[model samples]
Structures are given as C-alpha cells and as structure tokens.
Target: MQNQVRQLLVSLQKQLSVTLQSNRETLCHPVAKGDATEDEWLCLLKNHLPNRYQADRAFVIDSEGKLSEQIDIVIYDRQYTPLLYNQNNQIFVPAESVYAILEVKQELDLDKIQYAGKKISSVRNLKRTSAKIVDVGKSVAPRPVTAILGGILTSDSLWNPPFGESFQKAINSLTLSQRVDLGIALLKGSFDVSYTEKNEVQTKIEVGETALLYFFFNLLWRLQRLGTVPAIDYAEYLKVIDELS
Candidate 1:
C-alpha cells in the first residue's frame, strides 16, 4: 500500500511539472494562463488531501464580519462548519474552518513571495469564534484556533541557485504570522518550515524534481496535526450582523 502511494505521488510530480511548463509557453495571455494554473492546483488539492478538508477558491470570513483577501486556494472543513454567503456561484467560508491557504504563481521571487505573505496574513489575522453550544454533550469546550497553513506554489524559482541561502533568507525574513508553512517551486524544489523547541522558524529546503510530492505530504502531515477547527458560534455571527444592520 505504501509503495503504491509513493508511485502515485511520483507520477503526479511529473505531471505537475509538465503543466507548469505548458503554462509558460503561452505568448500574450498571461492572466488566462495564471488562472488555469491556479485551477490546476485546486484540483490537485481536492483530489489528494484527506477528505476532511474541502478545497476551493473563495473569500474567507470570520464571525466579526471581516473578509479575507480573495484567496487562490482555500482548504476548509465543510463537514463541521456551516457555509455562509453562498450566491449564484460564489461561496464565503468561515475562517475557523480554513486549514490552509496557498498562492499560485508562474514564477516565485522575492517580490511575489512578499505578496503571498500579505495574502496569508489577511486570513490569519481574522477573529474566529470558538463558542460551544450547550446542547452538545456535556457542553464541549472550545477548540483552539488551529494554525492555518500558508504556502506558495510556483512553476519555478528566480534565485541564482534555487533553494539556497537567498531563498532561505526570504523565508527567514517573514514574521511569524506571515510565515509560509510549506511550498513547492515545482521545477526547482520544495520548502517547508519547522519550529525549533524555542519556537524559532527553520526552513527545510529540498532540491529535486519530485518537489510536488514532498510539498503534498508535508502539507498532509501539518493538516493531520491540526485535527479540526473550533466549533463555530453561528449565533455570535448572527448577533454581530444584526448589530451592524
């Protein structure tokens, strides 16, 4: 079973590499190509990550009525959290349920890296509700707000020697709230951040053609550790919305 899974991931890495290369060949339609790349990533997450997480592209919301920046990929818990603000074809998910958010780019560089950090911070900084309903057996305690994994998915890297000190420096420069938990510079390599006993951030950079597989599994481990998001206090959200109106 383990070997079969490994083979599948290896094959997927190769396919993702080709997808990125094909996106680059387009001459004048950069925006369309970018959108397609993001779509491809969404599909990958939907197919691979544990069934507990639901992946899509949408704006994340919190109980206090704050909305996150439009995210390229949002992995949330549809099983335990209620869906709010669904329209003709749009959906707004609660921040409490989001397990991860990722930005997709054609090429990753220092500038784009900073942009990704900002996007992630917007979601992480929101106010989430953990209020438990009394009807729940013995009044369940509120679950801690699970850490939302932030990442970037790029076809390639712009560093002279990708995944070297330069890339490490970029990862180190980010504040704790803006740190990228895991990522894949597909054609170059994969990177995942770890915390020391003292909570200092450490970047684990892996250079190889099989980066997508590395990125995917590292992400899976992180998600598993998070367990589940806090039970949302829907009544709180309703009360706040009424006050605003």
Candidate 2:
C-alpha cells in the first residue's frame, strides 16, 4: 500500500511537470488572486482517496439543524445513509450520508480553532446518539463516523514549542478515532523574503521561487509513501493536471 501511494505521488509530480511545461503561458501569468493553494490541498486529498471511498460527498450538519454547514471534504461508503434528528419528536429521520468530514483553515485563528473543536464535538455527539437510537429501534450495522481536521499551518509559532503544545492540546481534546484515524497537516511557504541592514542601509533579499514547488512536490511524495493514495497511473494523472490547469 505504501509503495502504491508513493507511485501515485511520483505520477502526480510527473503530471505537474508536464502541465507546467505545456502551459508555460498560464504558469508564468500570475492570476488575479494568485493560486488557490487551499483548494489545491483539498483537491489533492479528494483525488487521492481509494476508489472504495467516495471523497468530498458529505455535508456538515449542526446539532440544532438551524444552520447548515457544509464540510470541506467527506468520504462515504456506498451503502451508508444520512439521518437527521428531529427536535420536536426526538427521533431520527433520513437526512444525508457522510463518510468523513474535512475542515480546512488557512491560518489558525482563535475563532476558527474554536469552531473546529465544536464541529468535531457535534459530529461525535451526533454519532453516539444516533447509534444508540439505531440499536434500540432497528437492527442494522453500525455506521462509523470519522472527522478530519486539515489546514495549512502558516503560523511559525505553531511549529515551535509552547504554541505547538497548546495547539496539540486542543487537537487531542477532540473525539478522534481510537485507531488514530484523524488526519492533520501543516503546510507552510517554503520561500521567505526579508530586509537586512547593510552599512546602515537597507537591502532586500528573496528566497528561491522553486522552493514552494519543491515543498508541494515533496508533500505529495511523502503522502504517497505513507500509503495515503492509490497506485499512480501516469496517463490518468497527467489528464487530471491538464484539466486543472
């Protein structure tokens, strides 16, 4: 499985290279909003899931159902069904099916962090209550719910000591699967630019632009190596890159 995943990453890299070469104009021309880096991460995860897992097809529901929140990504088994709890009757009804929930954050803000924790808690409570109801009312297989929190950890403090400790504490408080099925990713810009004082004057310097590309490429490669994706198909992989480009 791990080897297959690596193959997929390698295939993706090859496709990326080809796409960049073929679409030199597009690559060179900066978009009005630059690149959709967050969306790219979501897409990569969605596309890499095994065929058995239907990724990004689930919706997010609050405990009260008053506000509808859509998850960033979800994967579901074909047989799974969705259900909603009715406050009036205290009963569960067919609502929607969800395999997993994905949350994406660009920067770790306090509000977003709190929201993430609440989302996980809501999903956990829903699953537990629903399971009890199902066991008592109907004889059916149990439905497992998994929650995934993923984002670009752009904060330097998060990668360091005390801040990282706090962040990890918050994460560890969530109702994660016993198998450690939850996923978390931290992505940062590989290139940095700064100004330095030279002889009482200011000077500007920039890191290599290619560093960002390398970071992404290596990310894909490591994920593949970790068996997060299926075996690579160079032809199909290139096709995806072409479509995205």
Candidate 3:
C-alpha cells in the first residue's frame, strides 16, 4: 500500500513539474503563475492528507489580533480552532490552531529562502494561547504552546547542487525564530533541520528522485508527533483596554 501511494505521488509530482514548466513560459503575470503553482501543491496535499488537518491559503491571527503576512499554505487544526474570518473569499485562522506554514515558489534561491524566513517570522513571533484539552467535552487549564513549523515548497532550484552552498548560507543566516524546518525542491532535493538536546541545529539533505515521498512522509510523521494544536484560549482575545471619555 505504501509503495502504491508513493508511486501515485511520484506521478503527480511529474504532472506538477509539467504544470510549472508550462506556466513559466506562458503565464505573463508572475503573481498568477506563483498562485497557480501553490494551488496545485495545496490541492495535492488536501487530497492526500488526513481530513482532520485542513490545508488552505489563509492568514494567521494571534491572541493580540496581530495578522501574519499571507502565507502560501497554512496547515491548521479546524476541529479545535475557530475559523475567525471568512467573508468574500478571504479567511483568517487563529495562531493557536496553525501547525505549519509553507511558502511555495517557482524556483528555489537565496532571495526566495530569505523571503520565506521573513514570512515565517511573522507567524512565529505572534502570541498564541493554548488551553489544556482534557477530552472532547471536558477541558483543563492552559498548557505550554507547541512551536509552529515552517517550510518552503518549490518546483525547481537555481544552485548547482540545488540544496548546496547558497542554500546552506541562506538557512544559516536566519535566526532561530526565522528558521525553516524543512524544504522541498521537487526538481532537485529536500532539506530538513532539527535541534539537538544541547540546542545545536542539525541539518540533513536528501537528493534523489524520491525526495517528494521522503518529504511527504516526514511531514506525516511530524504531524503525528505534534498530536494536535491545543485548545485555543479565547480569554486572550478579550482585551480589557479602557477607553477614555
């Protein structure tokens, strides 16, 4: 079953590449081209991933009512998090519900990586409040919030080895809050970073035709490890600011 699923994903990836190639040559509007590419990946993920975790293009808002820059894709827990804003095609999700954010691009490069970092920081820096979920009907006190993951999804790479020198340089330049946990350059390879017990960051690079399969399954494992975003603490959203007469 796993082999069959991976084979289908590989075939779909080939189609995604073809779509990107066609858009690169025919789509004059850069933004449209980028959106189309993102939408394709988003759809693929939606179809393959579990329905409990919803993936969509939405802005993340925190308890302080701060909004992150529009992320290309947001994987959120809809079961526990309230869909804050949804009107006229625009949507906003609570930060406490966001598990991960992905920035999709046509090609992988230094500039794109830096841009993804900035976008990630916007969401990472926000204040998220969590409540302990005792069960479906019962609840307890708030708990420590989990870190939100971030990454990049690209159709191709610009560097020689794709995930080589320039890629490492860009990743190293980012601060802890701006770190991108994983990335996939479909035409080349995938890169992942993790932290050690001593707080040192460890990075791994996998370059092969099965990069997408590796990336996808790793993501599934991460989702399992994360469990679920804790219950959102609505009290944090109730600001008690006094108004002057």
Candidate 4:
C-alpha cells in the first residue's frame, strides 16, 4: 500500500510537471497581489502550506481579544479547534493540543526575542485556563499547543543577513517537538520553503501537485488575495478530483 501510494504520488507528479511545462508561460505571469500587507502574505502562506502539507486545516487569528494576541497562524485539527496560537494570550489552553504558533516579524530586531518569550508566557497562561475549565466540566476535553516565531526579511544580498539569525533564534527557542511539527511558511521576494526538512517536503509536494491542483488552489489563493471570487469553476475542479480519485 505504501508503494502504491508512492507510485500514485510519482505518477501524479509527472502529470503535474507536464501540465506546468505546457502552461509555463501562463504560470510565470505575476501572481497578482492584493494589498501587500504582512497579514495578506501570512494568509497566502497559511492557505498554501496546508494544501501542500495535506493538512486537515489551517487558519489565522489576529488576537482580536487580547493585547498580546498577535498570533499570525493557528493550525487546527479537522474539527477546527485551536491547536496553537502564534502569539500567546492570558487565557489558558492545552499545550499538547496546540501544534504550533507562528509569530511573523518582517524584520529581525533584538527585542523580538523578548517579544517571543512574552508570547510563550501568554500561551502557558492559556494552557492553565484550559486545564481549569476542563477540570470543572466533565464534558471538556484537553488539547495541546506549541509556539514558534518567524521573521520575513527581503534583501538582495546572498550571504550574511539578519534573516538567517532571526530564523535561528526562532528555531532555537522552540521546543524540539514544536520545531519538528510546526509549519512556518515565510515569503519575502518569492516564497522560501527551506526552513526545515518538512517544509522541503511540502515544497516538493506543491511543485509535484501543481498541475493537478493549480487551478483549484490558484482560484482559492487568488480569491484569498482578492478577498473575493469574481468567477469560478467549482464543478470543473470537482470533476477533476473525482477523475483523479
């Protein structure tokens, strides 16, 4: 079964490659941007990463309720509960349920380390709260959370930059489990997926599946970018998925 699945992946990859090559000219065209804000970029990364990772779901919450809530991404289970907050809040949540929290900073500042630590503390608080709630209510279930910090730096230099340092700090600070399990899809100039081995696998999958899923996710990402869909071919993509299945 593993071999069959791997074979299917390879075959799909070849088909996708051919499709991308045939449509190279069109694909090369600029991916139209919306407002070019950090949030928009984070949203794009979130949507794309999940599809690439075959994740059940991915989401972004701007910490609307809390002062320290600047979480950029929160990956959840298929049920859509919070696994992790990118930034921490005073509210207690489960640490095990949280996959990871990604804090995106555009620049590498020394102060951001302190900022990251503060977020972790808030996350710990949420865990405590979640535990208390669970203890009070027999119906309540426990969940875990993880946290990570990501910095996006764009520069022409090929070597010696704050980008590398910022990334190192984020990775170093995270628990080993979080470092291994978290997804931080950072985009500066083009999209960079070299943060970890898992990210590398995800990038390859995206490239491999581009032909089959391009139009599907292109429309999705574009809609996310535009914040609306002017036109779509929903049935057509569904037909493709059906055929593929």
Candidate 5:
C-alpha cells in the first residue's frame, strides 16, 4: 500500500514537471506563460487537497474593505467561511477564510522570493474578525486566527546550488510579516520552514525524485496543524456596507 502510494506520487510529480516545462518552452508571451504556470499549480492543489479546502486565484478582502494584491493561488476553507465573491472568473475571498497563499513564477530567485513575500504580506496585513460560533445549540467562543502559510512555487531555480547558502540567505532575509513558510521548485526540490520557540527560523530542504512527495506531505502536515479557520464576523462587513449607504 505504501509503495503504491509512493508510485502514484512519483507519477504526479513527473506529469507536473513535464507540463510546466512544456508551458515554459511553448508559451511565448510572458503573461501567458505566467498564467499557465499558476493554473497548473492551482489545479494540482485543488485536485489533491481535501474537500474541506478550496484552492484558487483570488484577491483577499478584509471586513474593512481592504483588498490584498492578487494572489496566484489561495487555499481557503470551504467548510467554514463563505466565498465572498466570484464573478467573471475573478474571485475575492474573505481574509478570515484563507489558509495559505502562494505566488507562482517560472523560476525561483532572489527577486521572485522578495516579490512573493510582498504578495504574502499584503494578505497577512489585512484585518480578520472572528465571531462566536453556535454549535450544538450552544455558543462557542471564537477560535483564534491561525497564521496563514505563505509560499512560492516554481518550475526551476536560478542558483547553481539550488539549496545553498544564497538561497537560505534570501529566505532568512524576509521580515516576520513577509516570511515564506514553504517553497517548491518542481524540477529541483522543495523546502519548508518553521519557527522555533525563540522565533528562530529552521528550514528543511528535500531534493531528488521525492521532492514532490516531500512538498505535498509537508503541506498537508502544516495545514493539519492549523486546524480550522475562525468563524468570520459578518456583522463587521454589514456595518461597513451600511455606512456606505
């Protein structure tokens, strides 16, 4: 059973790598290439992740009406907070529903890492309101908001030694609010970061054929640790709308 699972994972990784490499080689327009890359990563997450999670491209909005910069891929809670908007294929998810946000690029580099961090910060900086939940005819106190995971996904890496000192330095340079919790270069490797009790960053990098498996399982473990998102305070949104009238 375990070997079959491993085989399936390996096949998935090969398929993704080939498809993305095709996109990079065939797509001439930069925008088209980027869009295609994002779609591939988004679809991978959507197809593999649990039904409780919804993955898509979206602009996250807070109750205060602040909108985050567009995120390449957003993994949000489908079982808890409601979808705020989806019109003309443009989505706007409530900040409270979001679990993780990722930026998709053709290659991993210092510039791409910095850009991803900024995009992540845009969502993390937003305000989320948590309200009490009614469970089993009883009022339950609101769950505290979980730290939203942030990451960058790419087909390749720019560095000679992909997971060398330069790569570590770039990741370590990010500010607390802009920290990237995970990263994946499909053809190269995957990496995950965690903070120590003293707030120091610890990173684990996996290279070779099992890179995809490492990333997929690590992502699942991290998301599991986050539990469920808090119930959104819809009243806050309603109050804002009322004031606008």
Candidate 6:
C-alpha cells in the first residue's frame, strides 16, 4: 500500500511539473501565460482539496467596504461564508472566509518573492469578524480568526540552488504582515516556514522529485490545523446596506 501510494504521488508530481513547465515555455504573452498558470494551480487545488473549500482568483473584501488587491489564487470557505460578489467571472471573497492566498509567476526570484509578499499583505491586512453561531437552539461564542496562509508558486526558480542562502535572505526580509509561509518551484522543490511563539523562524525545504507531493501534503496538514473559518459577521455588512439605503 505504501509503495503504491508513493508511486501515485510521484506520477502526480511529474505531471504537475511537466504541465507547468510546458505552459511557461509555450505561452509567450505574459498575461495569457500567467492566467493559464493560475488556472492550472486552481484546478489542482479544487480537485485535490476538500469540497468545503473553494479556490479561485479573487479580491478579498472587509466589512468596511475595503478591498484587497486582486489575488491570483484564493482558498476560501464556501460551506458557511458567502461570496460577496461574483460577476463576469470576477469573485469577491470576504476576509473572514479566506484560508490562503497564492501568487503565481513564471519564475521564482527575489523580486517575485517580494511581489508575492506585498500581494499577500493586501489580503492579510483586511479586517475579519466572527459572529456567534446558533446550533441546536444553543448560542456559541464567536470563534477567533485563524492566521491566513500566504505562498508563491512558479514553474521554476531563478536561484541555481533554489532554496539556498539567497532565497532564505529574501524570505527573511519580509515584514510580519508580508511573511510568506510557503513556496513551490515545481521544477525545483518546495519550502515551508513556521514561526514560534517567540517569533523564531524554522524553515523546511524539500529539494527534489517529491516537490509537488511535499507541497500538497504540507498544505493539507496546515489547513487541517486551521480547523474551519469563523462564522462571518453578516450584521457588519448589513450596516453598509443600511448606509446605502
């Protein structure tokens, strides 16, 4: 069973790497190429992740009516939290529903890493509210918000050694709000970083054929740890409607 599972994962990893690399090489128009890559990543997540979660390109909005910059891929809850807007294929997710945001690029470099961090900050900075839940005629207190994960995905890495000293330095340079928790260079490897209560940082990198599998498993583990998104405070949104009226 173990060997069979391993072989299946290996096949998946190879397929993902090849597909992403092919897109990078064949697509010349930057925007078209980027969109294609984003679609690929979104498809992977949507197919592999639990149905309770929704993945797409979206902008996150807060109760205050503020919107984050457009995000490449947003992993959000669909079971409870409602999408704010969906028109012409554009989606607006509420801050409370977001689980993670990923930026897709053709290559991974310091510039791209910093860009992804900035993009991540736009989503993380938004306000999220939790509302009470009524279950079985009982009122449950509002749940605290979970930290949203941020990441970057690319076909390949600019750094020769991928997750080396320079890569570490670039990741370390991000401010707390801009911190990236994960990165995947499909052709090279995958990496994840964690912070302790003391703000100490620990990084783990898987630099070989198992890059996709490592990323998929690690992402699932992290998402599992996050439990579920808090119940959204719809009353706050109602206030906006009141103002409009």
Which candidate's TM-score is highest?
A: 5
- What are the clashing pairs of model 6? none
Residue 38's lDDT within candidate 5 is 90
| Clash numbers, per candidate | 0, 4, 0, 16, 0, 0
Relative to the unseen true structure, what is the C-alpha lDDT of residue 149 in candidate 6, on a scale of 0 to 100?
97
TM-score of each: 0.92, 0.42, 0.91, 0.33, 0.97, 0.96
Better of 1 and 5 by TM-score: 5
Q: How should the candidates be ordered by TM-score, best one leading? A: 5, 6, 1, 3, 2, 4
Query: Which lDDT values do the candidates have, in the order given?
Result: 0.85, 0.38, 0.85, 0.34, 0.93, 0.92
**Deviation from native of the Cα of residue 99 in model 6, angstroms:** 0.4
Better of 1 and 2 by TM-score: 1
Query: Could you give candidate 4's per-residue lDDT for residues 1-245 as a string of tens digits?
Result: 45664566456545433433344334344332111223343444455554422121223322222222534443223232343333333232223233334443333344554454455444334421122123455644433222322222211113244236554555456442233221222111222222455442222212223322332343234223422111122343345457779
Task: Please give, for residues 115-147, the per-residue lDDT of candidate 5 as tens digits.
Answer: 999999999999999999899999999888899
Model 6: runs farther than 4 Å from truth?
Answer: none
Q: What range of 10 consecutive residues in model 2 has the weakest lDDT sum?
A: 199-208
Off by over 4 Å in 2: 1-38, 61-68, 79-96, 109-111, 127-163, 172-181, 188-245
Q: How close is candidate 3 to the true structure, as a TM-score?
A: 0.91
Task: Residues 40-63, candidate 2: write the lDDT tens digits.
Answer: 544665675555445442344433
Q: After superposition, how far is residue 237 of candidate 6 from its true place, in Å?
A: 0.3
The ten-residue window of minimal lDDT in model 6 covers 1-10
Per-residue lDDT value at 138 in model 1: 77
Residue 143, candidate 3: how far off, in angstroms? 2.0
**Alpha carbon deviation, residue 31, candidate 4 (Å):** 24
Query: What's the true lDDT of residue 91 in model 6?
Result: 97
